[model samples]
Target: MLASPRPIPSQRLSRLWYLGRATGDLAAGLGFKGLIELAQSQAQDRPARIQISPEHARRFAERLSELRGAVMKLGQLMSMDGTDILTPEVAEVLAGLRERATPMPMSQLVEVLTREYGRDWDRRFKRFEFTPVAAASIGQVHRAETHDGHRLALKIQFPGVRASIDSDIANLGLIVRTLGLGPKGIDIRPFLDEARRQLHREADYEAEAKALERYRACLGDDPDLAVPQVHRDLTTPNILAMDLATGVPIDRLAGPEYRRAERDRAATLLMRLTLRELFEFGLVQTDPNFANYLYDRTSGRIVLLDFGAMVPIAPSLITCYRQLARAIIAGDRAGIQAAAIALGYVGAADPQDQVAAMLDLLELAAEPLRSPGVYDFGASDLFERVYRQGRALFHAGVFSAAPAPETMFLHRKFMGSFMLARRLRARVELAQLVPLCL
Candidate 1:
């Protein structure tokens, strides 16, 4: 079994030590220059295979978990953005950051409880589990029962994570640049700054509680979805309490026993919700981690969790995105180009062939929306096609500007949702669903 991460390093120097250790460990593996050369010479039919040793993966994960703030979040970001660039072995190791990290020891938990709820905090709960049920970068959640016998989940923020956010992010940026993990010619500074801002909001439990409530209201009367109700009396800036919502993890449906209809229903509901979030609610929980979604088999509803990454979308951007989709459906290249430029996806100076390739990639991705009915994700080769185009574009050095954080995050959510659908081999009437959003 993988070892649970040790205590988080709250002090600046302590955190810096953990990062330095991780960078050194990664450096011991295949160097970044080696990776860049391998990628260049890699064959299209059979890509060169290189893997980080298991020891390095474990070591990297451990240090990130120990740091448990912006550093850990950076690991998750690398896992997501490095899919095409990083070797699979390395990506697999980084992907583990998405799951629970080691929980804070009982002493630490008690200290937080005492700080938040006072000396008589034990009296408030009929029973509380000392061990956390789930742990993440900013906090870990415990299961508890109120004196009134109400079952609840308590989210306790790691001490000092909020204060350490800025420094941790700065340290993380330094480590990334030093390792040359970033792709050539792409300025990652805006995205890094955006991440710091987002992490600050996530560390604020009070803000998360409000976003949860707003999201619940936004998803009102949606029979297919469920959001936990916040217990305001028990909530504080560092703590959040809500009903103990129960369900199986959504990924369980990946099993062979799950029928096509059941899988399709889940995917369609998720896609529909995504559209509503973008076009109707104008707000979204941008992190689409499978663990954040639970399937209530009895209720047939998807239980939504983790409101920390929730963000608002600009109305004009949504308009541009919708226009882009409409143009794809209509085969209007000019309209597509106009919308792409408006959305900051293509630069005005990008070469015509490169722009054409980008447009082709966009059109391929939009195929589901353009289909009349039952777009089969199981049989689709769209991902491979898009990957090929994206690889070529990345090497051509024609794309310079990174999309705004808002657009990038929205795309992240969309792509993740689609990936889940593909994993379940879902068949969705996506064309029909697009109309509901408009």
Candidate 2:
């Protein structure tokens, strides 16, 4: 069933109003004791580490979700990256941002279509579904068929999403800072800047259409992968039209109905695709949300979706990664440290012990790559070990220096793949795949 339509707060003032209301709700939900704790923290002049109740978190998430733009997008990013820092209750609530978003009302949807395709836009289609098949931060996608009998998915942008990106990001940053909701002493400005840049690119459907075509070309004749073809006639800056690819969500492969072999194969293909995007195609779809992938069981292919978050990889960056990969595979500590320094994973001026700790964490992460044969993701506690080590480093002030934005985005994709593999309990042949990428 489609979510009940909610009009997006498109103007800066309107979005700010919703944010203020959400903040108000949070404060009220805290109760007297919580307010006292906040006052105490302020008196001491230390960072407020108030634990949000589940209900308060849910209310906050609902408000952001309703905005359906950069605010929601940033919330989704935080949900994924803030697991270590955010309380479990808050993280769990924010995770809902990844699911289907509340779609725009039909009247508003029609208005956008009319603006892009004229008042007689209905003449262009034999049938257009009023309900969205998928709703996301920037847009909602509807299944439609043209008079010529071509089936297409139309991604209609939320009105004013492009114009409101800057304000939405600024408002979100202010709220996070004021509430002391982010990590203490960490400079999140760089990440917020990256989010703003990415949001702008994503809001441009024209660019995404071009990115879709380019990515499809890069994957030409790949029997295991499928990318939808762009439908140029119906595409516009606010509307992206493409062939309607069919499949079940990729995460379904983790179910018992799927054979162990199938699970392994699916995960292996994804890992190989990630490597190819970095080392060969030089274009990576940086958003690793599982919804972006689908499994076509009938054809035994992985169908790719959503090209808005695609990023170009510099050759130099690829070279650094290749060096890092080879060093990890060979268990060469000196080579690994050198590559790490070059990649900005660790700074030259960082304390020796901190640098060594970072290197150890990197080595632990490369365990799968160094495995002689298939590495069983399900059997490994690698993620937990890495998380604990990372938390330790964070407390020791080792993560003060943020990696380059490109590196941060690329790692998000890598970690997404890793988490998915672990979820499916897949045994990937990283031993073979790592060499091919190098």
lDDT of 1 by residue, 288-316 (tens): 67778888878888899999989998889
TM-score of 1: 0.90
For candidate 2, list the clashing residue pairs, or say none: none
Off by over 4 Å in 2: 20-60, 78-96, 181-186
Local error of candidate 2 at residue 331 (angstroms): 0.9
Candidate 2 TM-score, true structure as reference? 0.88
Runs of candidate 1 with Cα error greater than 4 angstroms are: 1-5, 26-37, 41-49, 77-96, 349-351
Model 1 whole-model lDDT (C-alpha atoms) = 0.81
Tens digits of per-residue lDDT, candidate 2, 1-438, equal 446899888788899998898777677767787777777754553434556788887887788778888777766766663444456677667767776678998889989999999999999999999889888888998999998899999999999889999999889898889878776776888888988898888888899999999999999999999999999888999999999989877767988999999999999999999999999999999987777888999999999999999999999999989899999988899999999999888999889998999999999988899889889987887876776677667777787677787677898899988877876789999889979877
Scored by lDDT, model 2 comes in at 0.85
Q: Give each model a TM-score.
A: 0.90, 0.88
lDDT of each: 0.81, 0.85
RMSD of each: 3.0, 4.1
Model 1 weakest 10-residue run by lDDT:
41-50
